[model samples]
Target: MMTEQYVTTSITPLESLNSLSPYEVDQLQDASQGGLFRLFRQCSLAVLNSGSELDSTKLVLDKYAKFDIKISQKHRSVQLELVNAPATAFVNGEIITGIREHLFSVLRDLLYVGTELDRRCSGLTESEATTNMVFHILRHAGAIRPHVKPDLVVCWGGHSINRIEYDYTKKVGYEMGLRGLNICTGCGPGAMKGPMKGATISHAKQRQKEGRYVGISEPGIIAAESPNPIVNELIIMPDIEKRLEAFVRLGHGIVVFPGGAGTAEEILYILGILLHEKNHSLPFPLVLTGPAGSEEYFETVDNFIRSTLGDDAASKYQIIVDDPHEVAEVMREGLEQVTRYRKATSESFHYNWQMHIPESFQQPFEPNHENMASLKLIKDQTDFELAANLRCALSGIVAGNVKEPGIRAIEEFGAFEICGEPAIMASMDKLLGSFVEQRRMKINYKEYQPCYRLKHDAEVVEEV
Candidate 1:
């Protein structure tokens, strides 16, 4: 590792989260069991550490172990006192304006979700309550714009991607931007940042000053994949499930690019929701596209989906290759369908309230070793339910790859054991093996190791 550099500074917010109540300030500083201090520090460090090559949360925290942040309530507004922050976030000893904004955004969301969300979600079923909570979080962050047309497109892919694949994502995003569509992503680097970076130029060319590059992230994965520089609007949900829900509700359509485990998890999440019988006729646009050289990546993913979820689930999304203009055209046409469907159903344009998200998809999945082993990955259940379980399985693999807790768990206990139906296990093994071969697991692919192993009770297949 190179010699580390640090910066110390105080930053004041530009607008929102300028002030906080005395109780909120206390909670933020409280380092106790229910305190937000640890969460706040980790998230703040993530935004300040943007553009770093570190993709492992444990590694980032280890390097920045001395970093600390405090909320200082000034007479006029709130100021953040930073100690030993990453030097890259500053130039000539002044914090970058965008990084400063993101620091406050972290404070805003953490405070709102920790202190206010529970009371607002009272007396509702688990599913309704979660959806309501998501709405409140987005509205609080000013991400929901009423009376606007359906133009937000959620881009899901891996932060760990190759140069050619990353460039393909930018091309797709540029195409979408020229057509007046906004972008939403996981707020990380690689595939997530490429789209936003490409869209900025196109938006400027079109003179669309209000182009929204919304990034939705959660506390767990934020450190592993820091918020990219081009993300103007960042919303940090309480957990990964809520973060996924925020994307489906806030965006009109979705464009999937090449990715690894995390990307597969996102695909399963959306496909599971779309496969619901109630959502059979819903006109949500789902397109999977990449460059000409990325055919192997999509083929592996498609084969896995077909072998496991069957043909009906495979029919939910269309795959496109090497054609940015065509991808944009397809998204535009699909958005038109989305607009017509929402209007006919009398649903809000900003949020998709009419789409049915089952409780399985809404529930937060904890990807511990036990949960990973217990996932019902057999085909005995509904296709959507199977998708949900497989989503969880892939989620565990993602956690083990980068997230701090998961990384530490693997260090102590070794690789996680995933046992299930033999054929599904073989398909998963083949798909994940392809990720390893393609270098999609982490940024430092040469040093990467498998974090999970596959097994089954029945006779093992000789080939995948």
Candidate 2:
């Protein structure tokens, strides 16, 4: 077998991260249990590993096991020395411009979150604290713009989408960009990259020089979904929960393309928040759309929502198929409504402060085997609460599919057991099975195995 290529380089920040304290540099060099070394290395590697096809974090880490990064104070600023790093991040023996910016962004956020925000919000309640943390992170990253209109559109979908669906995402993004809307996504390839790619073209055509292509990620899944090359603004939230919260709070609207369990988790997350009675009067616009041939995808997603969260949850989003122009038109009009509502309510255009996100939604869900099995899938609670539990289930499945810890856990044990009310389990089974059949689970999907087993009545069915 051919040996893996590598690059050794020293790089400095392209922007504001021109300096770091000696203590901060030492913290990055620390590899102890309490240090930020592992987190910083993983995130930096993910940023450098852009455009990689491998989606498993374990596989990525294994493939680049020799990769190492060191930080030191140099010329009154921070300089990173990468040893055996991925060659893709460099061009002509130098790091790519965008990748360089993203690298410093990783350093900036990790240092700020680890050393600064971790101790600031001790007096607030859990939900308030979480939101406050998100706000602080975004503000620190310069993502929050005061007096800006509602123009940022958060796009949710899978990194493992087909070419047809991917092209459709670009088209939808083009239409939206023609009308001067910005794009935000998970910062990976496929659906996340498509809209940004398309928007860049249209932005050029419209001479919109300051278009925002925000990419939000966290430590757990960043390796699996590296920030795509098109992403101009990258934010690393503390975890998946905060990542999801940041999307809803920062964007005025959302458009979901065809995707897998991760996309389902996003859909359920927003739906659960909207289903809360306090947000019933809110004007957050959500649209689920795909190409014409991808109708079955939305149908399955819609049926799953109707079956599990009921019709009220289903009413929160509109599904549009095959028409990028109509999709953009609908979103433009919906955003107008959002603008008016924010004005009438005296809410900030940059953040959705008035939207009530349940504490369950805000709290992080650890996708361990026991946690996966204990999720309440029955209708014993309100629709929004059930949605939260179901969201956790899908989130666990996503972890099992791509995350390093979850994949390692599945290997140590077995497929995660998901026991729920029969109807709910049945619907979930069908939805996941469709994802499998469509090859949406992983990039290397031919060898895909079920990471979960659904318990229905007396029989347990393993999904594959």
Candidate 3:
């Protein structure tokens, strides 16, 4: 049963900035079309709607039709006024402490990104400026620590996973936590929340008080994948590209669990970066693991990678199966190697300053009908370029699966048409079909209608 209660209140900062300059306050209060008010309202609603059972962004907004938030400048500081907010965020008429922090964290990042960073940082290309902007937003959120070694492991997986897979992720996280490694994830449910929950227990057992469970999300995703309560540090990037970049740059290593199109998109993003010739010698560890049943899933992924990007890209990551202890042991060993490499090269321990991410991957790819149809999924392009195009296709499928706009687009325009080489189209169709059959697409597991159509050449229509 769902609880029903509504409250309207004004909240002041707890640990965040209590005061802002007059100009800054005015900028926040500006509710005009080009102002920050819309961004602030959308993100604020997402925070208030945390722990919601509903995953559809449009559904969430429609349910809370009367919800509204306004920024007010007080004598000494600023306060946020909420109207008809979600009741679950409140306990005994007071908002939860962690949720409140997340709320303000959203405010902080949105404001900094919109006003200060954009105004100050100009004359930079799309990629360089975007990466620099992500760095600034993270640094302002106090997410980066210069003294910390390379121990943060970014875990990517679906929020809508099975109980067995969720438990497996928790077990892996527990093993990682026992070894004193921190966790970073997309900050939603299922696989994202399971690892943090397990790590919390292990952190308690080890008497580690400040075990960081960082959740990085974007505006388009936050409403669907609300920040799980375990997320102590939450940073909302401007878009999906920057958010993905933050994950790779801030963490020392990455661990991928069984997931859906979003997971596939993440995998492609990392592979694209690692495929860059300049990043060849970098000591970044990539591992794909799951329980025994998930072996076939990884095999599909491995085969797809080999078929698409060739053997060199496949060599960038290792696949481990059904061993939580070994996963942690291998991650720890990798981190040690990372530390040695960073020290020897005099690179920063907190961020991967040496890795080169092309503008193709850094820029946001709008998964609209035209953009989806225009993707070049051929083998003739460079390996990195092929990875980028594959990444875009996966991203589009992810959008159609959960994102409200993409869902509506699919409903109106029908399935997105993806044209590519015959072999590549066959490989993609097989992998995506496996994902759907495995129930990895959406949280609502009745039956999934694919949002894409694969075309090989002008004549061949491949099965999806």
Write model 3 residue lDDT over 1-464, tens digit each, in one string. 54665679989889777877777767777889878777777778888888887777777778888989877877858798999999899988889999999999988888788778976569987777877888888899998999888899999998878889999999999999999999999999988998899899999999999999999999888888989999999999998999999999899999999998999999999999999999988988999999889889999999999999999989999999999999999899999999999999999998887889999998789999999889999888899999999999999988887777898999999998888888998899889989988888888758778889988667547555
Higher-ranked by TM-score: 1 or 2: 2
Candidate 2 TM-score, true structure as reference: 0.98
Better of 1 and 2 by lDDT: 2
lDDT of 2 by residue, 38-113 (tens): 9999999999999999999999999999999998776777788999999888777889999999998998899999
Task: Mark the regions of model 3 whose C-alpha exceeds 4 Å error after superposition.
Answer: 1-3, 29-33, 123-125, 459-463
Q: Whole-model lDDT, candidate 2?
A: 0.93
Candidate 1 residue-wise lDDT, 1-464, digit = tens: 42549988888888887778998999899998779999999999999999988999999999999999988887947988999999989888889999988998899999999999999999999999999999999999999999998999999998988899899899999999999999999999999999998899899999999999999999999999999999999999999999999999999999999999999999999999999999999999999999998888889999999999989988999999999999999999999999998899899999998889999988888878888878898989999999999999999999999999899998999887787898899899999888888888899857568888887884333321
Could you give me the TM-score of model 3 versus the true structure?
A: 0.96
Between prediction 1 and prediction 3, the one with superior TM-score is 1
What C-alpha lDDT values do all the predictions have? 0.91, 0.93, 0.89
Give the clashing pairs for model 1.
none
**Best candidate, lDDT-wise?**
2
Give the Å shift of residue 423 in candidate 1.
0.8
Candidate 3 lDDT (Cα, 0 to 1):
0.89
